[model samples]
Target: MTEIKFYRVNDAYGYLSNFAPYPFEINGLIWSTSEHYFQAQKFLDKAIQEKIRRLKSPMDAALEGRNRENPLRSDWEVVKDDIMRLAVFEKFCQNPAIRRELLATGHATLIEHTKNDNYWADNGDGTGKNMLGIILMETRKRLKAE
Candidate 1:
């Protein structure tokens, strides 16, 4: 069976917002893109949406929220959990159902240039850390054992 993985935070973000090759089943519904999944599972919650709206850009906030050095840490701190959920959902949204949905939505652009490559594979310079992908792999292992 093929495994799903996401490396960089941006790579996760891209997979959520742009493209993905897998589908994730969450909350009893299959999600193709993290964007759709998160929005439905996380963002639609009134409290979470209120917190996310406080940020200038949800995407930028997720990227910044990953690091303590964000100048907007004060704002991000309030919604940190939501941001992280969005980031992590990339790994969950990996199933055949998602691929079918991506095609149905007419947004499945998992082509060459559109693929999120920063951590999907190797960096052009041969230096990269697939932090998110690594975390997901271990998490999957633990869940399967239970």
Candidate 2:
């Protein structure tokens, strides 16, 4: 049951853009669990595990091409989106206007999100002081307040 549920969640995340391992939520005491985080981790684990499994087979390359083209797969999609987002930001960083606009707007993501790197670094660190999407949302809030 776990595996089946994991696959469904993984496929959806893989197919959808702006998808992550989790989204934010508030609950009792101003803290709580979210469905996005649960679903994202489930697939992230499977993608890593499956990559290991494929490495054991010499014909994995031939199989990989076909697997990526199939809509049933999310592994390629996730990788593609990350690469594409970084690529766009890298190009944008080269533009003076975009960089100036980003900084002037005071979007907290103006630094990290606009960077070509550090966008996808994940760690098993114990510190969980903040949620992933907090910065951009907060930026929006500040803009509205102004």
Candidate 3:
């Protein structure tokens, strides 16, 4: 499902705006802006991607432990746990208003990309980090642009 959200912050940390107290409910109804719409979309996509990469790292580590006799089976379990971890991460890191939307979507979507590589290709964060970094980066860009 395509996400639609609007953000109005006086300051990234704290600024000033004509917006009133209840911002989340603003919801493109009473007010809306396209720049915010695009930034939110980009930031959300980046955040979810980062979350997937971060979650898959431990699974990779689990598979690498050949010293453990039954590594393959252990790795499979790790893969399952990795997915749950990403869900928790996404729920915790996502905005409160969107949390329900995310949770109700795919509960067990596999990670298509990781920090290591995927489908014989290396297309990932490459640098391990949580979704915070992406949110912060996009927040900075959005704040600066406005």
Candidate 4:
């Protein structure tokens, strides 16, 4: 089976990355990227959520979300995967071009290859959970079924 690995936004499968510039609307608000939505979700404060949403870049949103000064929601660890699934699903659903792009991959394995993140990516060596890639594939399946 063909394996598709993506990290940087410029890479061929970059659109599959949460950091890709695919804006999506959820919870009645527009998010700049899945990264922004995912990170912003860590907080329960409306101000912090708005702040992350308005950030200029996904990287900035990520860094801001990592600032422990803001308290993360108590259920973050338990609900994070569902949150990511919703974010990725909505991203592809709202963006037609990318939706097609995602479906075009067929049955190929999608991998978020990065060393910086062991949970969401493959840790650049296939040891990490690669949850993001798993979510993307699940999203693709849902999209296909719809």
Candidate 5:
């Protein structure tokens, strides 16, 4: 099977990355990127969510989301994947250019190539779950059917 590895937002397949500057609206608010949406959802506090939303960059939003000082929602673990799926789906749907880009991939396997995150990436060794890639593929299928 063909595999498309993506990570940096500046790379060829960068649009697939959550950090890509794809502003999408969800829950009546516009998110700068899917990463901001995904990370902000980790908290139930509206203040925290707003804080993440206003951050200058997705990396900053991610950093704030990981700060244990602000307690995560009790059901974060159970709902995170679904949240990610929603964010990614909305991202492509709201951005026509990237939606076409995603649809252009055909059936090639999408891989989040990164060693920093094992669960969301390929762990740079093909061992991680690559949940982000899986979610992207699922989103692509859904988009194609639409």
Candidate 6:
């Protein structure tokens, strides 16, 4: 198998605008998207071993306030190092068992949702940004090529 170079997105602004990972379904509940996945794995779960310690919240004011130099940085930084260090997408894509489940029923078509859902990834036409869609598709293609 050819080596798959996973491209980690810039979380400098919360979820990376153009390269976020798509949501995958596990069990019956949907994971929503990669943002939620990162939060759950890298941010929320304390038991999960990570180089960067998880923050109390993504928008924890105290943490944000400490970084006066770059207030513009995404609140996701708390767990950013962990994600980057782990090369999360690469790990996520490599798992054949989980990948099979996600590919079988996960919603890869939709990117953007309604405004009430916070207009996430919307292209302003009710269509999702599909950022994760593009990344995952490319990953799948590369994985197949190998």
Best by TM-score: 5
> Model 5: per-residue lDDT, tens digit, 28-125?
99999999999999999999999999999999999999999998999998999999999999999999999999999999999999888899999999
Worst 10 residues of 6 by lDDT: 1-10
Whichever of 5 and 6 has more TM-score, that candidate is 5
lDDT of each: 0.39, 0.30, 0.29, 0.94, 0.96, 0.38
Global CA lDDT of candidate 5, please? Answer: 0.96
After superposing candidate 4 on the true structure, give the runs of residues whose Cα lies further than 4 Å from its correct spot. none
Which residue pairs clash in candidate 3? Answer: 10-15, 11-14, 11-15
**Model 3 Cα shift for residue 82 (angstroms):** 9.1
Q: State, as a TM-score between 0 and 1, how close model 4 is to the true structure.
A: 0.98
lDDT for each residue of candidate 4 in 1-146, tens digit (9 for 90 to 100): 99999999998888998889999899789999999999999999999999999999999999999999999999999999999999999999999999999999999999999899999999999999999999999998999999
| Candidate 1 residue pairs in backbone clash | 22-94, 22-95, 23-94, 23-95, 24-94
* lDDT over C-alpha atoms for residue 70 of model 4: 94
Model 3 C-alpha lDDT per residue in residues 10-113, reported as the tens digit of each score: 33311111121212212322112211221222222444323323332333322322223322342443353333333233322334443333333332221222
TM-score of each: 0.32, 0.24, 0.18, 0.98, 0.99, 0.35
Better of 1 and 4 by lDDT: 4
Q: Which regions of candidate 5 are displaced past 4 Å?
A: none
TM-score of 2: 0.24
Q: Please give the lDDT score for candidate 3.
A: 0.29
Better model by TM-score: candidate 1 vs candidate 5: 5
Candidate 5 has which clashing residue pairs, if any? none
- Candidate 6 — what's its lDDT? 0.38
Clashes of each: 5, 3, 3, 0, 0, 3
- lDDT score, candidate 2, position 47: 60
Clashing pairs in 2: 21-40, 22-36, 22-37
Residue 42 Cα positional deviation in candidate 6, in Å, after optimal superposition: 15
Summing lDDT over every window of 10 consecutive residues in candidate 1, give the lowest-scoring window: 105-114
